[model samples]
Target: MRYLFPTGKGYQRKWLGQDVLSGVVIAAVSIPISMGYAQIAGLPAVYGLYGSLLPVILFALLSTSPQFIFGVDAAPAAMIGGVLGGMGIAMGSAEAERVVPVLTFYVGVWLLLFALLRAGRVLRFVSTSVMGGFISGICCTIILMQLPKLMGGTAGTGELPELVRHLAGVQVHPLSLGLGAAALVILLAAKRLRPKFPMAIVVMGLGALATVLFDLPGHGVACLGAVEPGLPALHLPDWSAVSLTEGLGNSLPVAVVIMAETLLAESSFAMRDGYEIRDSQELLAFAAANLGAGMVGCCPVNGSVSRSSMNVQYRGKTQAVSLVAAAGMAAVLLWGSGLIRLLPVPVLTAIVISALLGAVEFDMAHRLLRADRKELAIFLAAFLGVLVLGTIYGVVIGVLLSFVDVIRRASQPSRELLGVISGQPGFYPLGRMSQAHPLEGVALYRFSGGLFFANIDRFQKDVENCVKPGIRAVIVDASGIVSVDLTSAERLVLLYRRLKEQGVRLYLTEHIGQVNDELRRFGAGELIEEGAVRRTLYAALEDCGAAEGEVKQWIPEEMRHAVPELLRQTQELEWAYGEEAQSKLDAMTGQVLQTLEETKPEQREQELEFLLERGRWQGVIDRDAILQHLEEHLAELSRLLERSEDAVLLELEQERERVTEALRRQHPEIASYLAAHREELEQRFQRKYPEAARHIHELRQRLHQLPEDETKEQR
Candidate 1:
């Protein structure tokens, strides 16, 4: 029962009042928009009200999302209208009415099948840029379709070219044009100033009031005539009107558009509100909503982004909002249907245009332009495709381009020959790091991305190019390579044989244990049995006799005040700044010590905080590392400031304790590793600097024996 009625998942008794108010607001906002989209779908305005009542109630009951609003929206209506125009069906005719319900039924069945198969997972492959472009294109096309209505002419049909041609030939009516232009300006201003306000309903009310005050119809300003007042009867679709195959073929794109738009909107709202939604259950909700639409002889319905945004803005907490909205639509149908007749056509058109304009995704286009021009080009291609070619072709082109881009990226994975920098602990790319150089008689290569058939030849060529004279060993770093296909594994064996013939050894290192299991299964177990697979790059270098000696250490007199270069080269720092990162560390340390010495005692703490904030360089250095370094200089700071050593030690210890607690809270794994390996690290430090190790040992004993009450107060 909970699964079926997911609206009750997190329901609260106190939220009913807010939900009722939000539902009324949503109903007020959706009434005009749905009526306008109904005309776009080639249906009567009453059917739009019919769609809102049942489909929304069904979706509210079945949806996994707590706040998403469902109704007749732009994309599916535009596509259905385009399909009807292509089929030579006249708007509002009996044949058109019968065919639309049949099409809606087919769309419902498709959605049901998709939910059964869990096809929601397939949507992950569609890129965000493609979705933005496709949606923007649909909104643009629909806006053009509504322009003729605003001018006291019939709606335009087909694609952008045909719509433009139709728009070019229409003769404008001055009174209708004036009303529409004024309504559009007001709606736009209200959206900018107070987005949560129900301006669409206000505009509709004003348009109606103006019609009675000025006799709009008598003055040749077109208005929708009186609609039949009543609830919709249960009317099953007459499937005999259209052939099953043709109906399914035309409805497939409509179903896809609805699923994509609705799921994306649902996911976005869930993320924003800090909740989770079941994708398959959402698909089921869409299926139920469309089925209800078909049963009521209405056009297909979908999730409404504008109304959902309004619901969130009004603090709607659960599906009670949707239920309340359904009741409001029913009340309007039963008693207030006559009011719609006085609403001016041009005013309604302007309301729709305003809503569609808001849907255009200009922010997405701007972001893609600034961040990645290649993606921007793809966005443009999809946008242009819809305008010129139509909705289905536009979606197809965008999806195909997205797949092609993915393949292109996979076929040219990043490959680099690596070497050591003078003061760094890890290998770096020889081309980018100026101080890095290849070790004597050894070549280290790193390939980032999965190994597959498409990139095996490139991988082989990179290895061959790096094997110069005197290169006795070629070590492959497989840390970045997560998977390998059978073909790549076979090629790796061939490369191993080739390198053996040239009097050079080949070794693979730093991959997970699963790759060895895969190699053994791929009939290349000899690579493992021959001891060619190593656990680490250093181990491989040692096996090949290339790691022969260590460089001499350059130690400072006061080891506590200065960190060793090797000790500063943490794995994360090396990954962020490959070479000469030691310089950044030195500058950071110097600035910290300088600030401590020059700042006044009263403002020292505040100034140190500001200094840390100003010195942050793109997060290349971690804050915990900086705090640890400062703690190491306790004695030096005491002597420089002429303070008692015990007081300085207590202050530094308090800061260190706070930072350690924060680290444990934010990054438990790193904190756990440091705590578990503290003794091992101390032994390594003692071996590297025996004299400094002895001095540090005496200082640690004195600190550990501090008064227990003082340590408790610090905590």
Candidate 2:
């Protein structure tokens, strides 16, 4: 089977008997409904035979789904029929019927085009909410469309509202009505009471029997009359200018709608535990089916879920079963159409209604009852769209909702602060009951989403809300803060300085390497500081005055035992960043400039140690390179005016404070060096910020001319 249907390698040989039995059962189940669906589609009963053939075999040959069955069915075709008919290609008029096959041909061509374009994967883009709504909408339409046929109208017009109105106009065709009612009753009974009996076959046999026994046509019964027996002659569809162009215009919407419905079914079924299909291959196989339908005088065909499910349940195991079914159907079209004609139209309608009932999926509605209301609304919207407007409108609305939902979710990611438990060592959300308590004086806050511009402000506000009155240490848990934008870095820096002002400590725990790397570039590396951060909340808690051994012992016994596992992750992060991943003590000396910029005095030692560890493992971060990155980030920030003094003034104040602290750290000897080598430092600073350098040059010259002692006195 893998070779016949190789997901990665292409098709292989697999007799898998269930496939064959499935084909036979589905063929038996589908044959009657397929014919009836053809009538509902206003296509010839023989066209129904054309519609039922070959598509399933092709789908099996190319699809990833192990159990998908493709054949003629009611819902999509019914919708297509009504849509096309409304546009004037209606049945009853021989001219219109001629146009039908040609319209189908055009639709097939369009679907083939879709498959060629690889549009199958579009299924995943649709949200579950939209699909729930849209499918319900389609189901509602199917149930409504069946109403008039059950009551007693010719399956004419193929339009729901019109069919009801048309039924009101026609005197009840009693023979047709009785047979439809009987077929409906029997098929429903077979389905509910006797699951093993083939409902399609049972209803069909009874329908044929009743027609023969009652001598039905003598009364006002609508039968398919005398079906012309023989293979439909291989005739090219007249795509002459007027009809071809008109067909193209009208059929495209039908093709798109039908194909979408088929893909939706295929995707849904594929997602189930047992059987899944290759979506890309489905498109091609469906294309071939469409081309085949057009090659014969058939209306468009699609995968039939009910019949396929039945076939599998009946133990079908091979594509040959579909082939066998197609062959049987071909024989019927050749010699049995006339004999089958005596089978009352109501009987056919009953078969169709029974099959379509299975498609309604009330289970979907039950799921809605269990899900969130917003999701329920999406499902209902699709349901209502189909019921009120029709299947076509319903799916379009579904597609739109799906797109909106995806954008909404990704754009608005949730955030939370994670805190390390006092005795547990490992981190959990500070808000969650499992680990609700904050470190005694330390605030361990976890940011759950990526730090992007869209979410940065909310993140800042949440952190501020936590930093109320007497918080001593503020731990920023960056494990959840996976990705970052430069703006996010600037916002982070503002928080870092804010905590510093309250005389609180800021520790970054579990800093994702990617985000930490971005922070490093944005001058946040200096602001957030090194050594202040830990990979695990346990380690961070230990640093923040919690006794390391006691905390370790307190870890919920399950996790307390996994200390080594957690340590491995920490080691991996430290290994990735060399001198940059510095410890407080190791960060001193040659990295004195970095130490000077450290956001906290405590982590300065830890950061230097981290740097030493980094140097030991990897190597040094070039001092010039680090400075260049920081200067560039600063340059970028300077250009972004706060828009107004009040807009982000606190953030601005925080930045100003960090800069002040860094500059204030210059040693007396370094200060003396700055005065003695003012020109060299000035040139280097100018090279980094030429415009600022020009402004500072005059001040330096004025200071030098005035005498350094006078400048020192003014300071």
Candidate 3:
């Protein structure tokens, strides 16, 4: 019993007063919006009130959600109205009234079946982007449908094109248009100024007062004629007016919309409030509410986001708020129904339009635009599909698009070439990390996402592209690949054979134990027996004779000249400025040399500094690298000029010393940073390339001995 009626589980005495106040607020807000939605559903406005009373009470009694409110809402109503228009049923006529109740009965039946089947879990596949787009599209379509009524005409029916045509042909009624425009403006302003205020009721009351004060109905402004003063009568849905097949067919989509929209909203509220809702119970609650709606001759009903938000804002803590709201509506139906007759049709249309406008997912569209363009496209497709096609087709298009997006991503997941940085422990993507370089005769590859028939070809192609003449071993980092299908396993075996034929060993590394079992099951157990599968990349590299050796000898020949840190920085420059980065640096060096030759001796330092500033070389290359390159260029210039080598070198060294001193004085921090960075790079180079470090030390010691020998001979 506690599980069935969970609302009282956490109830408190103090919450009752707040819940009652919130319930009243919800009733006030629901009056105008539900009435508008009833018109959208092709029912009389009074049915909207009936829907609010019984359906809400039933939902409150059964719902696992303590705070979620259910009643006649926009999506299900718009869907019902669309189906009616398609069937050539006239709005508010006897046929529409009969068909709508039958349709509501079918919708209730569907929800009950869904609850029984525990089918609420299937709703997880519906993406938020698709829902936002679908709802936005529905809201826009209903807004267009309501526009004609605001101008003293009947509401437009069918999809966007027909609605546009009806809007284009609408004859302007000055008084009605003015009243609608003013009501719309006031509602919008009040929403902005005080979001939680019961402004819809206030606007509705003002419109009703205007109708009575000025006799606006006499001046060609249509008003709701009269409302019967009583509670709704309970009756079984009469199905003789519409065929069984047509009623069932039309009602399924309405049922789907109600289920999708309500459950999504319910789940969102549950998440926000840090509570858990039973999805199956929520479905049951919807079924019961809609069945109650059908019994009362009301249109299909669903959860109302606007009223639920208002309830939460007023600190309504339990389902008592829903009961209180039902009572408030019952009171209006019993005594205050007469005032609804004085409500102007245009004003009601404006209120409906305002409510629908709030329902549109404008903020969602904005977020998708900034975060992911692909998701935004999905949103647009759903929105446009609903606008161009009808609501059901729009939902189909959005869902189809979502599934296609999923397939597309799976078919082409991110893949990268892995390499090792000199001082870093783990393998990194060669393209992204500047200091990372491939080990000679071995390729480390990382493929992100599962291997399946759809993506195996991509995986094979990427691996083949990474293979070159000297690459004797290929190690795949399979940490990202969680699962493999039969087709992918076959393809993997073929790839291994192909690589083996070409004298290249293929090893799969860093995969889970399940993958090994899968490989064995797929008839690739030979791979494991042959020692091609390993637990880690380092182990694979060790087997391939790549790890625990001189890093310079293992690295590519082109990368062997510089320290790994410097090589990394240079690669970064190449990535940013393109492959011509080295050529550009040389060109800038030539320009600086020309400036130094052209300038007077006194201005040479100033000219060189100006040339360096203009070159913007520091943005691309480090200060230490630039200084080393300048010294090399000066040596080359002296050799090309064929001057006395020692004399030319002495003069160049003095000039360099003076300029370096001036630069250090002008920018001491930069000079200090470059000096410290150079020292760190040298240390890393010595650690990574000990043999080369020893050779350089020997050359420096020999040079020092030669100078001492010359001094001894002179003595």
TM-score of each: 0.71, 0.71, 0.70
Ranking by TM-score: 1, 2, 3
- Tens digits of per-residue lDDT, candidate 2, 96-137, equal 456566766777788778877877667678776666566545
Report, for all candidates in order, the number of backbone clashes.
Answer: 0, 45, 0
| Alpha-carbon local distance difference test for all models | 0.76, 0.59, 0.75
Least lDDT summed over 10 consecutive residues: which range in candidate 1? 551-560
lDDT score for residue 491 of model 2: 76
The all-Cα superposition gives candidate 3 an RMSD in Å to the true structure of 19.4
Worst 10 residues of 3 by lDDT: 568-577
Per-residue lDDT for 1-715 in model 1, tens only? 7767787775788998879878987776567668777878889877888899999999999998988899988778878887888899998888888889889988999999989999887656667677677767877887887899899887776788989999999889999999999999998898889876777778888998999999999998888756678999988899898898989999998998788767765765675578988989999999999999999988889988667766766678888899999999898889987876787989988876786677677788899889999888888888888778876688678778778768777888888888887665677889899888988899999988888899989999988887999999899998888778899999999999999999889988777666776776787766764547765576567668785654221122243123232223212323222343344455566678887778777676667667665643312124545544454555666655566556655665565567567646534445654454445445744676577567666765776886898656533
Model 3 bad stretches (over 4 Å): 5-22, 32-44, 64-68, 74-100, 238-250, 264-277, 305-321, 549-715
377-414 per-residue lDDT for model 3 (tens digits): 99899889888897658756866887888888889899
Model 1 C-alpha lDDT versus the unseen true structure: 0.76
- Judging by lDDT, tell me the better candidate of 2 and 3: 3
- In candidate 2, position 240 carries an lDDT of 63
